[model samples]
Target: MLDANIKQQLKTYLQMLRHPIELVASLDNSAKGRDMEALVLEIAECSDKVTVKLDGDHAVRPSFAVAKAGEAGRVRFAGLPMGHEFTSLLLALLHVGGHPPKVAPEVIEQIKGLKAPAQGGHFETVISLSCHNCPDVVQAFNTIAALNPAFSHVMIDGGMFQSLVEERKVMAVPAVFDQAGELFGSGRMLLEEIVARLDTNAAEKDAEKLNAKGEFDVLIVGGGPAGAAAAVYAARKGVKTGVLTERFGGQVLDTLSIENFISVKETEGPKLVAHLEEHVKTYDVDIMNLQKANALARTDDGKLAVTLENGAKLTSKTVILSTGARWREMNVPGEAEYRNKGVAYCPHCDGPLYKGKRVAVIGGGNSGVEAAIDLAGIVSHVTLFEFDSKLRADAVLQNKLNSLPNVKVILNALTTEVTGDGTKVNGLVYRDRTTDETHTVELEGIFVQIGLLPNTDWLKGTVALSPRGEVEVDAHGKTSLDGVFAAGDCTTAPYKQIIIAMGEGSKAALAAFDHLIRH
Candidate 1:
């Protein structure tokens, strides 16, 4: 059922359709199958060039192929497409209908040059329709398939495919898997990173080639706001600067809304991430995306030798660890089992998908309280649970939470289990420590807003670490190591805000540049 406004928009968007696009739906007589057929037919009715063909012989009840008329489908989407994925579906239609690829030229060339395995590779991108970052990952893989015929890509809705999500242990969205390995971590990643992930041999070779250029003047080890800021600053100095990151944007991509980023009144995590990447790309910094620093050591020549997970090594004169933090999990039963199914971490990323639904926010801290207030505006009702006797959030945040009519707060409640029907989350079970009474709250989703753990586990023993495992750094973002620096949430920075991280990253870059000048 397409709304009038949306149908009109689609009709306008499809007005310039150069060629016919086909939706080859593989469906049986099941409910999901019938729904899939209806969805495909609805999409086709929007444009004269679009058509739907039903194939009932497939083993899978609800799978589909999207391609041009009389052409074999190169892209397939399994499971229902809704929420954020609806945007992905519309974009896919535009692409397959003869629109040009929006990817960079070098990226297109690299993807085109990718050679599939002898038997061909079947790439699967596990995504939650609600994830803001998931669409880009899907678009990148689909574009790659469009550019190169050697490979094909399928997009699976993580929420609908609960068994597959569990089997993959998908804690986050955009979890890609292929014969090669997990391309990047479970989050938003640069498109080049996705391409590099699918072809590690080529990536390793690229890393080797880059390293052969001798030591860099400054090497930033993370791709968050701070690392990106540092990269921009250092590269502007006309020095050989390189940045190594598992993925760009770091925790920023996990965030949903930003009202205090300075200057901007409001923005989303992914938009800011795009700005960060765009700003970094304006410089000549050698960005090694999808690369993690496995180990760090000082070379005999007074340079830093950074080993990657793929066994590649890069040498730099100065290094900055801006590795960010990840959301803390509850570790309760069914929490991990029903991650995307009903248990979510980033309220900003997944909140819209649960609009008008009952949800719970775990934790009484500022993050949890803030999430409750935020979700109250989108969802029908929000239940806030805190293990402490009272809320630990700032008085202002507590006041905001108290003012929300759709939110209910529970103190001294210990979450025991995330109740689900082996498919999606349905309710949450907890116990009141004060009365020793158990309570089960019926809700479709639960948002865990505990705290964040620093991403410095890989740097253990190499750099000075605090008692809490955060990287110990000086005021100038300098680590105990003479030529190394650290910043952002991974460091000893008192604040973990986006603006603070950007400032810290800039400081770290300047410190590294100063060290280079001194030596």
Candidate 2:
């Protein structure tokens, strides 16, 4: 055995090596024992704030692949931090010692100049990209990992870690695991809360555990137009409502504008959603934003169990689904580049903005032909391109489109390229299948009138789905499952109109009320 004096010296040296004041080249396992010992002893003799740099003699790249807790000195018995992720390794060393990484000046300023040491606690950040829509949220967690090593962070990419995601009941991105091991915060978290959770100990854990127990009368699982309407309706009825949403505005936020709703002639989609939010908030509903619904299980007691992104759960007497649909996009070259710039999907939304402009319509179906004829009256010209040999629209609409003098019907043509001048669209390139020729149509906008597909894949087995994948519901918005009902674009409704979704939401709420009273 080594002398007691030698062991003390070695331990002190290891502590110094891990200090925030020092920068290490590499704490490689390949280093000779004697060489390490000598380095340690030499550093012990130095001043209180000794800076012992690692000897650059080992591979640092493939060493710190993943970071974890170190028992006394070594972590995971592997300690091979890999990649230029070596940067993460450095931050890990800093965590067991120095303060959390400093936030940017702007972020620091935004937090009201609040810079307190993180509470002495633990947080497990869980993320699952089942829909692959929340990458920004995952980046937020990675930034948290970059902050302090004392914070144990693991990314559960559901695509890669399906079983773990199922076991944890994670259905969305950015689920926060609290110190109590009970899931706490779900979805994107404010950085201040993250800082507060760091280094927080057991006493606080007990309190948080007690604070998370409560149930709602009605739980709304979406924050779109229909969902928002339902929330307002339920809360006003004094049913004690709760709203869980992946995004606060749901699919309505993606809309550019809305002219159909019974509003002030025209309104932007986001503005309309914001107004709806105000109405919903006027009631007493519990609002949980940026949260994705994870699971729906019926408790043995017959209460509806709602699992969320972070594994936290709630009990509800009735559940309403208002998560809406996304507009279909033609992901062709330049199409995405000019979307919202020159490529618009909803004619009723961005039509007036393009008055007297030349526009190209890409589908030959009913919606496409109608949009083309509509634009021909407003825009300088309209070019309708269809992949089929003939238009699939109704006879009346087809005759109307053909009768429009300014509308040019390009039969058997497919979009190849959307050439643009960065800010706006210049022209479109088309390929004719019959002639085996390609040409470009110089225009200001390309309106995508392709049919829309509802975003109901997440509900495939959660609730009943139609053959086309939309949620199946009755006129009263009752679903196949008890205590569960659906509305809006995600359901198998005939017409996908704003008024229709709102009307359905009202019906769903009444159904929920009746179900709750009966039970």
TM-score of each: 0.77, 0.50
How well does candidate 1 score on lDDT at residue 271?
88
The global C-alpha lDDT for each of the candidates, from Candidate 1 onward, is: 0.83, 0.63
Quote the positional error of residue 261 for candidate 2 in Å: 3.2
Q: Encode model 2's per-residue lDDT on 164-282: one tens digit a residue.
A: 44455443334555556656665334454443343244225433442395788889888887788888888878888998776777656545457788757887655777788788888
The deviation in Å at residue 361 for candidate 2 is: 3.5
The C-alpha stretches of model 2 lying farther than 4 A from their native spots are 1-213, 254-257, 262-266, 331-360, 364-382, 387-407, 412-447
- The sequence of per-residue lDDT tens digits that candidate 1 reaches over residues 1-519 is 567788888888887677999999887667777788888888888899999899734444578888878878878888777777777777778877887677778778888898886546667888767677788888887887777878777888766676776666554567778746554346566678767866757666876775576678898899999999999989988889888888788888767679998999999888898999998999898877778788999998788988888777888889998999988888889998888778988786667667778999998998899889988998999999999989999999999889889999999999999998877898999999999999999999999999999988888899999998899988999998989998899988997899999999999999999999999
* Residue-level lDDT for 42 in candidate 2: 53
